[model samples]
Target: MRIVVLAGGIGGARFLRGLKQAAPDAEITVVGNTGDDIHLFGLKVCPDLDTVMYTLGGGIDEEKGWGRTGETWSVKEELAAYGVGPDWFGLGDRDFATHIVRTQMLAAGYPLSAVTEALCARWRPGVRLIPMSDDRVETHVLIDSPDGSGRKAVHFQEYWVRHRASMPAHAVLPVGADRAAPAPGVLEAIGAADVVLFPPSNPVVSIGTILAVPGIREAIADAAVPVVGLSPVVGGAPVRGMADKVLAAVGVESTAAAVARHYGSGLLDGWLVDTADAASAAEVEEAGIRCRAVPLMMTDTDATARMAQEALDLAEEVRA
Candidate 1:
């Protein structure tokens, strides 16, 4: 099968691993979200891309879910001693090597898509991972502080890592999205896909960011295959990450049915909700998309693979 998956960071990476286990022979192409990319210490840091690559490439810190395995904090400590901060986002020494290479390639006039391919050359992440867009598209969060002043826009990472999503967000903006074109292979992958799966990733920032790129959503809508989505909301809350906070920013409800409707039947052909939300299946189906209730928890590889199978099964059902 030619499967195209829209991915975010840690959760997307884990789901991809399970998808591989579920269908080892299938061809998978991942369109990774690049809205979290930031320039730090003169190096280009693509957090979401690196997270997926390292997690699948077997160099990831499984416990932390981000950064490299067997990581050391000497570089972080030294930087801190020099009063060079933004210490909230931990960039390990080993992970720094990746940013260095990526930055060098980008500076040498290689597009981000090409630089990502060059980086993946060493990691061999198994699937072809492409950025959502070659053009810069950064996700920013608009939030009001404790003083109740006007809303101010902050980088997604700053809202996520530094503030921990504690503040109420007024809006979520994908800066530069209006002009950002999908990366070279992104639309083609979706256009030629046998199945398009939306992993149980943060809908607003992860999958939503990918869709923000021009032509990506249109490609999926125009694809001849089924487009299926797994709810990140298992039981009224996200499996991981503060997805609810961001979802609220866009006036979307946090329920499984509401999230499915947020993506809408126009874009999605099938929706997978947790067994706990079986009651909501009918509502989703009523929205013009086929819905299935299954165990959507990623407890381990086996459980995640089961979820992947369920999604594929639903895709087949919708196609039939």
Candidate 2:
């Protein structure tokens, strides 16, 4: 089987791990969200792409869910000691090397997709991983300052990593999505896939940002395979991350049914919610999506593989 997965950081990476185990023979292609990419300290950082690569390649810090396991912060600390700080955004010494190499490759006229492939050569992250777009598409959140500093937009990282999404987000926009084209193989993977999946990543910023890239949503909708998704929200809350905040910004409630409706039936053929949210299945199905409720937690690799298997099962059901 050929599977194309639209992914973000941590959650997406973990899901891919289980998908690999669940369907050991399947060919997997990951289209990672680059909207989370940022330029910091004169280096380019592709957080989501790196996360997926590291996690799949056995270089990831399993407990923390991001970054290298045996990481040092000498670079970050040196920068802070010089009072050159955005200390709130943690960048470790080991992780910094990735940004440096990516920035250097980009400066040498390589597109991000090519740079990603080159970097993956070292990590050898089992699947074919590609960026959603070769162009920049940073996600920014519109929020009002709590201390009467008035309304302003901040990078999505600031809203999430810095403030922890505590402030109300009035809007979330992808800064360069207007003219962004799908990275070379993204549309081709979806079109040639037996199944497409939306992992339990942050729906609004992760999956939504990928879809915002021109031609991606259209490609998924027109693909001849089953396109399925697992709910990030389980029992009225996100399994991880502050997805509810961005979902609110987009005017969607953070529930299994609401998330399924947000994606809508046009692009999604199957939707999986946690067993705790089983009551929502009918409402989701009523909205024209085939809904199934199952154990959705990823407490371990076994648990996550079960979730992936369920999604594939749902895809087969949709295909029938």
Clashing residue pairs, backbone N/CA/C < 3 A, model 1: none
Reference-based lDDT, residue 124, model 2: 92
Query: TM-scores for all candidates?
Result: 0.98, 0.99
Per model, how many backbone clashes are there? 0, 0
Clash pairs, candidate 2, are none
What is candidate 2's lDDT per residue for 1-320, written digit by digit as tens? 99999999999999999999999999999999999898899899888999999999999999999999899999988998999968888889999999999999999999999999999999998899999999999999999977788889999999999999998999999999989999999999998999999999998999999999989999999998999999999989999999999999999999999999999999999999999999999999999999999999999889999999999999999999
- The stretch of ten residues in a row with the least summed lDDT in candidate 2 is 84-93
lDDT of 1 by residue, 198-266 (tens): 999999999999998888999999888999999999779998999999999999989999999999988
Query: How accurate locally is residue 71 in candidate 1, as Cα lDDT from 0 to 100?
Result: 88
Runs of candidate 2 with Cα error greater than 4 angstroms are 147-149
